[model samples]
Target: MSPRAQPRGKLANWGSSFLPGAYAGSYVNIGSMKPDAVIADLKNGSLNRSEQRKQADLLAKLNRGFLARREKDAQIEAGIEAMEMAFRMQFSVPDVFDISKESQATRDLYGDSEYAKGCLIARRLVERGVRTVQLSHSIDGYDIAWDTGHGDIKGGHARLAKACDQGIAALLKDLKTRGLLDETLVVWGGEFGRAPTSEGKNGRDHDHYGFTVWMAGGGVKPGYSYGATDMFGCSAVENRVHVHDLHATILNQMGLDHEQLTYRYSGRDYRLTDVHGKVVKDVIA
Candidate 1:
C-alpha cells in the first residue's frame, strides 16, 4: 500500500487493522498514529497514552446504545479493535525501525539516501516478523516522489533509480543471507508508469495501460521477466495483467484462491480480485 493512497478517514485503518467477522486486513504499522513512539508516550502519559484511553472510553460509551438495542455496529467495533492493536504494537515495533542496531557493513550496503534508510527499515520490520511493509519516498517541498512529471526526467529518474537500485539490491541480499527471502515476498513498483511520449517539454504523463511490476522471493521464478509492452511501451501488447489480475496472482502466490476468498461487507459478497481475475501461473516458480 502507498502512503499517498491511504484514505485519511474512518476507513483509514481498514487494511492495517483486522476486525472480528471482517475480511482481508493485516498487521499494524510502526510510528503509525503512535508507531515507534509508544514507549515514550507511556513514560510521559503524553497525549497518545492518556488521551487514547479517553477516546476509547468515549467510543465504548457511544457504542453502548447500539449494544443495548441488541444491534451490532461494525465501525465502533473496528475502531476499538484498531486501538488495542496499536497499543500492543508499541512493544514490538519500536525496535523494528531502529536500523542503528544493524551492523555497520549492513548499513553501508543500503547506501545513504532516505529511501535506502527505508529499505533497511523494511528489512528490519520483516526480520521482526512484520508480514507487510510499505515505503514511500518523498522530497520536501515536492509534490511527486517518483513520478517525474513535467520536469527534468534525466535528473529526476537518475536520482530516483540510484536510491531504489541500491536499496532494492541490498534488501534482496539481506533477506537471502538471513534466510527470509523464500518466505517473504518483496514487490517493487508503483501505481503506473510514465508515458514514453512526453506530453510537454521533457516530461511524460502517467501511463496505466502499460507498466511493469517486479516480484521476488515467496516462490517466484528468480531472475525471470514476464509480459511485455509494444515498441513504444505505450500499451501492454502481450500478456497484459490488469490490476485485478495482478491482485489474483499475488494472492495465489500467497497460497489463497482469489475467487474462493470472499468478504462480506454491506451485506454483499466482495472478492479481493473484484468480478474477474485469474492467476498468471507463468510467473510462479
Candidate 2:
C-alpha cells in the first residue's frame, strides 16, 4: 500500500492561539458540523478561539459561507477574501500574496508544470525562512507518473525521470546560485522502488528490499553514491542504509545526536531512530 502522504488527515490542527500569516487548506481540522449549525456559529462569531483553534474555525466558517451563498457572481470575490485572510493567518504575513505570474524564461527553465512549480516554490519558501520544504512527486497529470510497472515501466519512468531531472536540477542550480545549497538539503526518492521482475500482465509489485534515493547539499558528500543493490536490484548488497539509518542521518545533519535525541514516552525513552541507528559517518561532510 502507498503510504499516506500525511498521518494527520485532511484537517490540520494549528493549535496556536495566534493566527499565522499564511495557511493551506490542510491547516484546519473541522470536526463533524451540519450546514445549519456551521452557518449559525459563523454568524454569531462563536468560532474564534484563543489559540490555533481559531484558525481552524475560521477556515470552516469561510467554507460554510461560500457554500451558503452559492452566488454565481459573488463566488470568486468571496473566495479571494477568504484566501487573503487564510494566508495571513497561516503564514503570519500581514498582506503579502503571490500575485505575479512566472515569466516565459522562468517557466521554461522549470519545465512549465506543477511538479516543477512545486520544486521552484520550495526554494522560494526556504529562502523566505521557512524551516522545511517538501516537494512530493505526486501521481497527477503527466500520463506517465511513477508506479511505472503498472503499464509501461519505460514510459512512466521516463516521464518521472524527465520531470525529476529538470525540476531537481533547477532547484539545485537555484539554491547554489543563491548560496543556500550548503544549508538546504534536497532529497529525491520514493518510499520504495519498483520490482525488477514483471507481473503477469507487465506490472511490477512493491519491493522494499532495495531502492535508490539521492541527497544533495546540506553537507552531504557530493557526487557520491552510497550503498548498493544486487544485480537484480532485488536486495541491498552492500552498505545497506535502512530507513532508520536515513532518519539518523537526517537528525545528524540538524545537529542532533541520534542517540541523544530522545523523548520519554510510556515510561521509556523513545527516539526517532528507535533503538537502531548509526550516524552514517561516510556520507557526512
Candidate 3:
C-alpha cells in the first residue's frame, strides 16, 4: 500500500494479522455493512453523498485548529481520514455486501450459513478486484469455535466443519468458474494446530510446534504439499517454514521483495518479514 494513500488503508481488514503494524492510523474496521447503515446519520437515509462530504468538510474545518497544535498527531489525522473514507466507501460497499443480487444457485453453492455469506461476500469482493480477502471459519479464540475440541473432539469438529466447509468449497468452485481463482489467493487455517493428544475426554490442546496452512490459487502450485510433522503431529520433522518465511513467500507471490519492502519508524527501518524470511519457492507455481 502507498504511504501517501494511507487513508485508503482504512479498507484494510480489521483482523490483527491483516492490518499493517508499522503504519500508525492506517486501518479502520469496516464490517460487512453499507456506509449508510454504519454511519449513524445515514441509517435513516437522510444524508446523501453531497451532504455527507459537506458535513465531513465542516468537521475537518472544525478540527483544523485542534490539528494545528501538533506537528504529527496520528489520532487527529486518522479522524479526518476516516471521514474521507466513509465518503469513498459510500460508492462501493453497499453493492458489494448485498448478496440478494446473486442467483439462487450461486447462493446455494456457498450454503445457507453465516460462514456461507462471508465466503460469498469475499467472492464478490474479489470479483470486483479486491486484492486480499480473509475468512475465519468460526468465532474467535479456543474456547468456543475452532480452538475447541477439548471435550468431544469427534462431534465438536464434525459439527464445526459442517458449518464451514461447504462455504469454503463453494468459494473455491465459484471463483474458479468466474476465473478469479487464478489471481486470488485463498488461505485457510488457524494460528496453530490442535494437539494430537486429548485435553479432556476427547478435546485437544494447542500445539504451536507444528501447524498447517493451505493456500489455493494466486500462483500457488495446486496439490503441491510441502513440509510435514511427525506421525503424532507433535512437531515438524521435515521442511519447517517459519511464519517469516510464509510472509516472505506471500509477498513474493504479490511481486514484492520482502527484504526491500521496509517501513521507517523511530530512526530504524522495519520489515513485514523483519530480518528473517525466505520465500518458499517450492510452493510457487
Top candidate, metric TM-score: 3
Best by lDDT: 3
What tens digits encode model 3's per-residue C-alpha lDDT throughout 202-256? 7888898998999998899999999999999999889999999998998998899
Which TM-score value belongs to model 1? Answer: 0.80
On residues 101-211, what C-alpha lDDT tens digit does candidate 2 reach at each position?
A: 445765577675556666765676677786665554544432224757677777777776776578678889889988999998887776788888987676787889999
Model 2 scores a C-alpha lDDT of 0.62
Residues 11-90 of candidate 1: C-alpha lDDT, one tens digit per residue: 44345333352332433322232335423443324556667668767766767766668577766566656656655555
User: lDDT scores for all predictions?
Assistant: 0.71, 0.62, 0.71
Model 2 TM-score relative to the real fold: 0.67
Q: Considering TM-score, where higher is better, how would the candidates rank from best to worst?
A: 3, 1, 2
- Residue 37 in candidate 1 has what lDDT? 46
- The 10-residue segment of model 2 with minimum total lDDT is 28-37
Model 1, runs deviating above 4 Å: 1-71, 141-143
Give the runs in model 2 whose Cα sits over 4 Å from its true position. 1-104, 141-145
TM-score for all models, in order of appearance: 0.80, 0.67, 0.81
Cα lDDT, model 3, residue 168 = 87
